[model samples]
Target chain A: MTTAAEFQIEYLQYLQADGKAKSDLPSFASDETLMVNLYKTMVQVRAYDTKAIALQRTGKMGTYASTLGQEALSAATGAAMQKDDVFAPYYRDYAAQIQRSVSMLEIYQYWGGDERGNCYQNNPHDFPMSVPIGSQCLHAAGAAFAFKYRKQNRVAVTTIGEGGTSEGDFYEALNVAGAWKLPVVFVVNNNQWAISVPRGSQTACETIAQKAIAAGFEGIQIDGNDIIACRKIIGDAIDKARRGDGPTLVEAITYRLCDHTTADDASRYREDNEVTNAQELEPIKRTRAYLTDVGFWNDEKEAALQVECKKNVDAVVEQYLNIEQQPLENLFDYHYAELPANLVEQRQEVIEGSL
Target chain B: MNELTLVDAVNQAIAHELASDPDVVVFGEDVGKNGGVFRATANLQDRFGENRVFDTPLAESMIAGLSIGMSTQGLKPVAEFQFLGFIYPAFNQIVNHAARMRNRTRGRLHCPIVFRAPFGGGIHAPEHHSESTEALFAHIPGLRVVIPSSPVRAYGLLLAAIRNPDPVIFLEPKRIYRLVKQDVPDNGEALPLDACFVLREGSDVTLVSWGAMMHETLQAANQLSEQGIQADVIDVATIKPLDIDTILNSVEKTGRCVIVHEAARSFGVGAEIAAQIGEKALFSLHAPVQRVTGFDITMPYFKLEKHYMPSVEKIIAAVNHTMEF
Candidate 1:
């Protein structure tokens, strides 16, 4: 474990940089299915990222944000969270939603710009994907306050990019989280670029993790490529926040292996060397090596796992695409709690036209 | 008439609503010990105790965000923004988050957050304090906006806003908050948030307006009576839903229309009125709908203010222009 005087960088990490498994690591002993499930979910998210970029090229989805290199941060965070805990995802948190049993169709429909895809009609504790920069951070903080008010023991987890720190909502949320000692964890996945604007241009601060200092809360910077390390840090922050010790700002230091979204061309702004260097820090590859070395899996099992995951993804994709189209009239109907006069007329006009 | 100022009536409404519903809470900057900048929340913190009503920091976005979160958790949050202009920082929470929460969650979660902001130009205040941004909120989907003209409407409409399942932008007419006095029921029942109120009836022309402009619209109708021009005045309390039936029926009777507002003329609430008339009641009009609105300029200091505000004279002049057309 890397320890500093101000912050304790805890590592439940099973592997070192050389891909060797550690002898001692905390076990998720309560359930092995959950561990298998997390790995499967992460693989599914990676598949979705790859498929979504291809779809965007073919013009199916609009400006999609791919969580390619950052799956470990999202999956590990969601895996460490309590079952009943609420999760508010930013535009790129597909892995968190996937780990929560949110179908791939729902996530796809959402990034596709259908508000219905955002609706969690069945999920009891999931929020829609928020895209207005740092606005969702305040919602997470407020949810944490509500949980504390109702005496619920659930931690609220949400994410933002490093550039999101410049928004007023981010500071306001952190201040409220500090002042009220709410059970919320703000994870700043410092993927370097917030849509082409690099980290240094966004803020002169040495690190985004250091911003939490003004709010009287502590923060930790972690190597996000370490999946187990990300899991342990997120889990500790969640537990601490829920105990009413207040919120923690986690800066998962990582890089975006892909473009910001399919609409972007990183070649214009980013150098080939930068991306090539990030390839050496593949989070999935690191985790897989440890699993193999620790006798958790073999070459055959790994191949089999990939085949099963691809088959599952293909089946779901087919099912979702086969679904029929819905009418546009429902758009105006959901605009207000009850039908407005103008919308009522607008809906009638559309229906008449369709007829 | 049992008279009460608009500010007093709003305070009474909040107090009565808090008394009636245990789920209702109130908070904002200078809202507790200071009793709010306009004293609308005066005696509230003391009467309801600090938990139910209290002071929040100067963070407007966080305040609005907390309201949306609290409302989704089944609490009725009546939050205050010191001024209408200050709410821009919180527009993400108000417009994107609170307004869309219900539609985003399907039927699972509904945010019943009421944003009570003092608005408009008659008050010779700071540059930012005198703004009529009602049209902006009205343009957004999934939000209900209300602007009351007098004490009674302020009391009743606010209570209606408090009970709405979707978020409501309750813009109080700051200029008329301390100016107007009228009887309001203290029994705590609010009117529907989707309907408009017909303040005056005539058959020559229909005047559609809301908020502080309601009084000016009525005054214009009164002025037109001397020249034998009968003008029907309708106050669109809930601007988003825009009680189109009342407006269409009124315009259909008059065969002429004049939309009045204190917001800038271009792309303001008046534009919607003119557009709706053109779209829905085009054949009913003897002439095209005309609008008497504030000049297309930023709300300047107290000196150049009169030119920026609409009055009875301006409304009558617009009526004359529509009649000539």
Candidate 2:
């Protein structure tokens, strides 16, 4: 008998839970600006998440999905990509969207029931934050297909939760990306829970990254809580994609330290002990501890960073609150390039009827 | 000018668009080396090369999402579903994403993709192959559903759909894909969308139909003309954002109206036409609008497809009933 297929799923963990690296650090870890920038971005995203939850509690915004513990995943993935590369991100990727130049104010506007929130000015290639689970994965593949067809040296990166990986769109996208050899990367934030359902119930596969193996691509797992591992692994995958080496599936193992959304009460399904343990392994605290251990950050810098992040978030919130309600005609206007005659009458009807 | 069937005209139009625009791409199942299932994209991959015209994985949802993504990035992707019934898997991408992309993005990004599917019965295809679900697409706020009843219209309307800035669901009548032949010039002239073409002039009753059903409708009109009951015939090419002005004008001239369609009667496109006629042209002093349509049931297999479809007799009877009133 001959062994036909042999496969292995690689796992990466650079920084352990206590903020200690098990081995020698990559060269990029020594770059002071990059290290501090990652830490600061995680802090900013955390502050933004707290403020968004507050706004939702006060009835100022819609129910928001929080990236409370998965900050390193977004920071690393967003920072790794080139400017021209497109990002088809899911709703929980607020940190990544901000990195792509989708302003925090715009994200605020979106959660506050405004369409203009998705209108990106700086990074025009990035798609609006997709709310319908795993649908953006296919969009990423299509964008990659366009790049490959046009011979453009660019890659498309999409982020999704472990729950999104279960959706049929995820597999279909990966299948196409693999078969076509498109320049795309799928970053699965394997946060242990998909609403009330835990990761155990999501799939029978040992690791979500292994799901990519059946699709004919390299699949790898990484310590999503460790910024160094995230940055290095995702940056390497992106470079490979940009070099036309085909797609990669990256399952960043992390935990959701918050409720699924502001609307969810995770305590009903998840035990307090589990949440407590996961909190100890949270991305922001681990990165902060790593910075402290290296003497690159101190108590004074940590306090000042917190205050700065709060100030920045508050400024964006103020800007978001000042925006007036969009006109009613805006609803019908953007539906088509040129409003047809029937819609013209319909728009007038809406105006007259409102009065 | 070459005389071609509706399917051949569809191929010609795709070839023209791919030749004229560097950004236009055509992809679907078996659309490349095997051509399309219906051959609507025959010889396209060979003509435009594999990059411009290609085959996609058998996943319809991915095909739709891919088109939406490509369209946002300045490519005009004309994706074909092997058949209309297969499009249900992709309905989410069509209705939720592609249709709403422009509105959700506040016009900053728009999908200019054309989703083509061969629809309607009478082709003797296997189960789940024949369907006429245009009304579902027409009801979507941002989607434009256009169906062509003839070769000339197929060539022109397909070109127009490829050129339109918004997403269009171009439901080609597969039953008529090879049924009729007409002169379709290779000049790349696109006909206007959201307009109706008055096929015949009459004074008594107006007959409205679209897609493959137009054959029975026009036949009935000609037969009705022989009986001294002159019937005005209109082919509603664009089902959504309909040319109500033309339909109303024809209705006003001919006080009686009969809407013909092959889709189910309940909440079908015929119902919309009837409701609009009652709303605007009600006082024209004629009979209540009559609808000659298919029954509300799953489109049955080939054996009973004829019984499910509207026939010339059914349309003529409706016209006669309206004229007598």
Per-residue lDDT of model 2, residues A1-355, tens digit only: 9974578889998998989987888999878889999899999999999999999999999989888999999989999998999999998888788887889888888999899998987778889989888999999998998898899999999999999999999999999999999999999999999999999999998999988889989999999999999999999999999988999999999999989988999999989999888888898888888889988899999999999999999999898888999999997999999899988998999999999
DockQ of each: 0.57, 0.85
Docking class of 1: medium
Could you give candidate 1's per-residue lDDT for residues B53-172 as a string of tens digits?
A: 888778998999888767766788899999998998888788888887777766567788889999988778987899898889988888888998889989999888888777888999
- lDDT of the structure predicted as candidate 2: 0.91
Q: Model 1 residue A158 lDDT?
A: 84
The segments of candidate 1 whose C-alpha lies over 4 angstroms from its true place after superposition are A1-14, A21-24, A27-37, A57-62, B1-3, B223-230, B280-288, B317-325
DockQ of 1: 0.57
**What TM-score would each prediction reach against the true structure?**
0.92, 0.99
Error of 2 at A291 (Å): 1.0
Superpose all Cα atoms of candidate 2 onto the true structure and report the RMSD in Å to 1 decimal.
1.0
- Model 2: which residue pairs collide? none
Candidate 1 per-residue C-alpha lDDT over A241-304 given as tens digits, one digit per residue, 9 for 90 to 100 = 8788889989888788888888788999988999998888867777766666656657887788
Clashing pairs in 1: none
